[model samples]
Target: MNDIAAIPVWAIIPVSLLLIVGGSIVLIGALGLLRLPSFYQRIHGPAITVTLGAGCLLIASMIYFTVLQSRPVIHEIIISLFLLLTAPIVAMMIMRAAVYRDLRAGKKDAGAAAGGIYQFPEESE
Candidate 1:
């Protein structure tokens, strides 16, 4: 007998809901990436949504697999931990790089809008 068939309807409902919600959140993030006007703004879409979406998907996988195996499957927790740790750091690094680049190019507005935290030497003409 296939393990998939062993999953009860009660377990299936939440798993399906998680998958759908996760997918929808990811789609919204993609749309935000495409629709947002600026790089600073665009990064937020994926950075925020990816974490939430992946979390939901991971939970769905855990529930589905646990139900199939008749055991508690918690490996997703580690994956989630890594993702939660890294995603924001990566996004911050990318934003910092962009801000640095903009500052080096004499665009003070970018640095200013970035809370004026970066100090770049003014280019002598």
Candidate 2:
């Protein structure tokens, strides 16, 4: 097997910390998705997972590869960028669909208006 570069202890410490923290955040986000009461609230859980968790993981990957190879290993940024951009759109669509479905079912909730249409009061002249 080819010899890998001996990573410095100092570098390893921070990288390890990053990996642990990111993994924990990802786990918490997953827990929130399972525990949250509403669909809208749950929509935000994976955003946190992708943004903080995936972002740190990619950074860790980039750092480790670059250090071992003695070159810029920034290809991991593509995954990070894709997650950051796509997570929000997917979350929003899920939330919107949930709202539409609930409205269609006509469940009476405080925020949900009649016929899913809000009636704004007229301002006095």
Among these predictions, the greatest lDDT belongs to: 1
The lDDT per prediction is: 0.92, 0.75
lDDT of 1 at 88: 99
Model 1, CA-based lDDT: 0.92
If scored against the real structure, what TM-score would every candidate get? 0.89, 0.79
Deviation in Å, model 1, residue 51 alpha carbon: 0.6
For residues 1-125, write the lDDT of model 1, one tens digit per residue: 67767889999899999999999999999999999988998999999999999999999999998988878999999999999999999999999999989877777677565678887766589
Report the lDDT of model 1 for residue 45.
95
TM-score of 1: 0.89
Q: How big is the positional error of residue 24 in model 1, measured in Å on the Cα after superposition?
A: 0.6
Across 9-89, the per-residue lDDT of candidate 2 in tens digits comes to 766777788899889899999999899986667667877686989888888888877887889988889888898898888
The residue pairs found clashing in candidate 1 are none
As a whole number from 0 to 100, the lDDT of residue 21 in candidate 2 is 86
